[model samples]
Target: MPTQGLEKSYSREHIARQVQRLGEEISRDYAGEELLVVCVLKGAFLFFADLVRAISLPVNVDFVRVASYGPHTQTTGLVEFRKDLEMSVTGRHVLIIDDILDSGFTLEALYQKLAGRKPESLKTCVLLDKRQARQTAFEADYVGISFDSGFVVGYGLDYQESFRSLADIYLFDPAQSV
Candidate 1:
């Protein structure tokens, strides 16, 4: 896809710094404990990978995929589970990692689902938190960045399955696309 309509939001260095800070914080919080890092795909894949590596703890990684925005910029208020975690979360210190906390539907739904599994402790982390767009009352325990508005793409965020491989994040304006 062309990058004609994209405006840089966050540089790769900035994102890395934030991720490292989060990792350190997480490591400190869960010191002497094992962590189950559950990644929300496919947006969180890159963030998840970097986060786990930065975290200095014994962490087991798993992935779950949910679809709320099939091919749209905004959510449809429906969350469908495409994949589930293979590892059990019971009695584990679990952390849910996601790309963005938009409408709160996807993260909240996934959080509730995992909470029902009865983990010893459950918390959430998001690369980006857009409080203005929230449709449900939900908040992430850890947030990498905050934005008032804009559909972002890059650093694993995407639009129509593109721009995810970009090194930095950008405000995507579809109307300006070539």
Candidate 2:
């Protein structure tokens, strides 16, 4: 592990089960419709791949890169769109996937931007939901897990762009930061 005092919160099996359940739910809800899955890049890439594979329907995938957190533990509060979706989502069922929902600022901003594109319906799916850190009035339509608060890394999440490759999700103990 890159960081000491880290504790495993969610095992790889647990995450797989959750992803399967979510995929089933999505497939059931949008059985007759085509899905355009938009993945928030870098962090959500791993989760996005697994999730799309789980879905029973054929899905079109696109990636958008946004940054609100820099080389620190907290959000910078300024969201920057490093990249945008390549395909148009208009008149399509669009699903936005992210690794985590932290302060909601980044997701909220992205939602508004995509919503303005006039997708037939837009929904958000997040692997981790840190509700305690939410600063905006935005919520994911499909959430895998809801955690209180911690700097978590694994399964596509990172710490200063590290630890994302871990199979299990681990919580970074702030007291151990040096």
Candidate 3:
């Protein structure tokens, strides 16, 4: 695997600190309100778990599996729901948690679909925002960090469904990729 030469980017402490900050921000913003955290599954699971723990407020959690990219490097541009949320978001404060915001198509499609469900309020949060790769009109309400376009793995992000168990994030060397 090209990841044999995986170069560490973000450290575990850095991630924890940012996650705490995001939790505090989210907790303050949603004070005294019923919070429903929608985890954009597979990738955001680890981040979602840590984030919710940092939040002091009571919040419900749900998972939704939406995919725009398969095993390839680029997005297919076609979003599909592999798994849908079981709970009704109606009248609830909804926060969608995603691992990364790349092209914005998946997030935009999800926002529109969730908006149609009549949630009292809907917001988006992302662990990493690659602003340069955006191909659609969208923005994250809360962002943990931002970086230039690069393949990252660890702390919930993955490359071909591996390297997710690493303690910190690593930038994959494209030149090393086969």
Question: lDDT for every model?
Answer: 0.94, 0.92, 0.91
Task: Identify the candidate with maximal TM-score.
Answer: 1
- The residue ranges of model 3 lying beyond 4 angstroms of the native Cα positions read 1-3, 174-178
lDDT of 1 by residue, 1-178 (tens): 5566689999999999999999999999999999999999999999999999999989999999998998989999999999999999999999999999989999999999999999999999999999799999999999999989989999898889999999899999877776
Q: Is candidate 1 or candidate 2 better by TM-score?
A: 1
| Model 3 lDDT per residue over 101-129, tens place | 99999999999999999999999999899
User: Which number leads on lDDT?
Assistant: 1
Q: Give the TM-score of candidate 1.
A: 0.98
lDDT of candidate 1 at residue 85, scale 0 to 100: 99
How well does each candidate superpose onto the true structure, as a TM-score? 0.98, 0.96, 0.95
What's model 2's TM-score?
Answer: 0.96
Worst 10 residues of 2 by lDDT: 1-10
Error of 1 at 63 (Å): 0.3
lDDT of 3 at 39: 98
